[model samples]
Target: MSPSAVVNKRAVVVEPETTGHKNVKTKSVLLHRHIHYEPSTVVAAKGNYVELNSGQKILDATGGAAVSCLGHGNQRVKEAINRQLDQVAYCASLFFGSSAGEALAKELVDGTNGQMARAYIVCSGSEAMEATMKLARQYFLECAPAQPERVNFIARKESYHGTTLGGLSMSGHVGRRALFEPMLLGNVSRVSACNAYRGMKEGESTKEYVARLAQELDDEFVRLGPQTVCAFVAEPVVGAALGCVPAVPGYFQAMKAVCDKYGALLVFDEVMSGMGRSGTLHAWEQEGVVPDIETIGKGLGGGYAAVAGLLIGHRVIHVLDKGTGAFSHGHTYQGHPVACAAALEVQRIVREEGLVENARRMGEVLEKQLKERLSSHPNVGDIRGRGLFWGIELVRDKATKEPFDPKDGIAMALHEKGLEPKHSISLYPGTGTVDGKSGDHIMLAPAYNTTEADITLIVDRTTAAIEDFFAQRSYH
Candidate 1:
């Protein structure tokens, strides 16, 4: 039970059979990710672990896409959901206002200290992103002088907004966008991402790298015509693509400055890195620049419910307030009471227990543990992140920064191996990281309430699983 005892334990090095490529047969009724796949059926979950029907207890390392910030099966959140279910579980936002919805929105807006004036709750991050895009169009039309010429948006390359058509159109995630390109809108364009690991040029200072990225944004706006741009959108700390990459210092400020010069809004997609992921309630808080419109998800409800919201900055809210006094969009479940109540209590626990601060403190511990254990490894090209959200990029050649061939399927291999009987540790896998088509990495986003034991165990399990993987690989 002692902290030092926990940290000092020898790592459980899972064996090399963690390759996970048996071409196993399946009787699966559900079409899980792959064709007729039969993965371990998780029948129960508690705390940071899920139990399979085969009696395997897997450590929930990535929090199921970083959604279980409060950890699994939280009794308090369950109780809150029960309370809301008793009162009113469902109410159309178009017709009636639920107290849970209003109170949660008020609490969320209050957390922003009035930087954001309104909250438009939705069922998912993709929906919230679609809303942000649609609202941006309405905003320009409703602005003074009614500039209809503002029809284009500039988002960063390798960034992920969401999976819906509008969201896909706004996103430049090559892997995610490839299949949907034909159906996507053509108004959005992209510039370089603000990743210093691979983006920074040879012998370039951080200042020069940021300056060049800023210039790229400026050029993109110029190419699109300044008057035609409606907004410049990016994730403050990128998720999925490029693997937990945060912009260089002053990066957001510089990008915001360009948006300001072009009379365009600055949008931050915090769907994966917000709500206490990066040691702050909002990742933008650490960057020192507020976004004109921000979309948040994943941790918003702590996975207690499918919930996401658009946090409208004062500028955008003020424009809508003056012009329409009503948003032109709404869903049947725009502000579901049960979902709102779950998120509200989850956030309340976060605030009362000081979990965001815990994220900051524990993040340092996790980062240290990961680097100490994996940084010197040949394939671990880089280790980078903040708060509890971290990533380990795998490469074929470390010195040249050459990534493994996509056919190697390294990230997914580790992903599957982590779930093998001996390891039984869940990890988040990402592909097409270097260019949206050829990079491999494993993301680690644990709970904000993760304990020292959880951190140590995560690091240990991750080390074991990865080591088990590379041992059998002939990546030459």
Candidate 2:
């Protein structure tokens, strides 16, 4: 832990990973206005596939950035949505109650063994994250007679929450936070992620690595004056930022102990990893530890609706009910009936049809296929993930562990190439795996209902695309 030791550790650099395709069609719309153009238009979607305006059917390998968990089209979810539309599309949660919303909340709570007492639904993950922050603050104000000064949060570096101001404040993704750094709130601190593939030391065992991370968390709490630290926030399985990296064994337990010692809340941002993405109803269940507040989205509605929610633990609920008599926050669309209906049906399908178990089964097949096909590839650095979520970390040199230059756009090239008519596959591309500036990786979060044949197709297409990409690179 010496300064020299830290200095000796090479820092990862993240750079742009894009294809220099000049002739691609451009859009006149503002879009994510700040970012550049060349957008592809989707004409339609069905089951785990999407058809482009060009009439090509591309396999959705990453589930539209891991949002389409139940696949592109699900009749059950569609029928539920249509049924809710027939009943009521939107109902004001402020004064009125909707059966869809009530039923969904009850379902969520029941699924979690009633560990979650109350639910607050929102339109997107960012809203849920923002609500979580405010709720955590309110919990502190209402509970603990000491009038604690704990207003700070401790989150891991390279983590993402959302795009809203509060969510941005809690997020530690360097690229996402860079431009908005000046406007972000100043109540958050960061620690290293439990990224064993990159963060673990050469000789360290997984147990030792987890212990070290736990000690680091303890030290961070002490440095920040534990009494002033309100919550420790992290993604149970890191999503976009690190390519679906799960924590090492015992890591969560150690961190939970530290949080308990400091009387700080643990917030799990399961926006991408929850709702059976990691083979469990809740990712925390896999860790054998529960968070004081849990944010869930993405797979919740399975892309059938825009919905996200915060599952408030009993302790936080008790504190809020006692002090404020209500949560001191509200959004116009807090609990949209249609969204809840969609999510309810999605959850029901997952449980009734047994998609969680399917995710577990296919996830093993995926891991085996990936390792067998790409583990020894010179540029394939590390392959890691849980359940249906997985990432392939790409490096330039296998022995030296050097990453391809960001200027090379290796990951993006792979993605663009995969979209070619011959390849007919779509991949989620990522950069900055080495830090916030220099590495490349491709993430895969296939649909939970994916069949064995579908898995084989994906592996075949992905491997073929990768091989062709490398071949072209060698020629270049």
Q: Estimate each model's TM-score.
A: 0.94, 0.93
lDDT of 1 by residue, 1-476 (tens): 00000000122111111222345567767654344334556699898998877788888888888788998999999999999999998987777999999999998999898899899999898999889988998999999979899999999888888877898788877766665678999999999998889888889998888788889999999998999999999989888777788888999998998899989999999989999999899999999999989999888899899899999988888888899888898898889999999999999999999999999999999999999999988899999998999999999988999998776667877888888877878888877789887888888888999988889999999999998889978763
lDDT of 2 at 71: 90
lDDT of model 2 at residue 26? 51
Q: On residues 350-383, what C-alpha lDDT tens digit does candidate 2 reach at each position?
A: 9899999999999999999989998877778899
Model 2: lDDT of residue 274: 92
Residue 109's lDDT in candidate 2: 92
Looking at candidate 2, the ten consecutive residues that score lowest on lDDT are 1-10
Best candidate according to TM-score: 1
Which runs of model 1 end up more than 4 angstroms from their true locations? 1-31
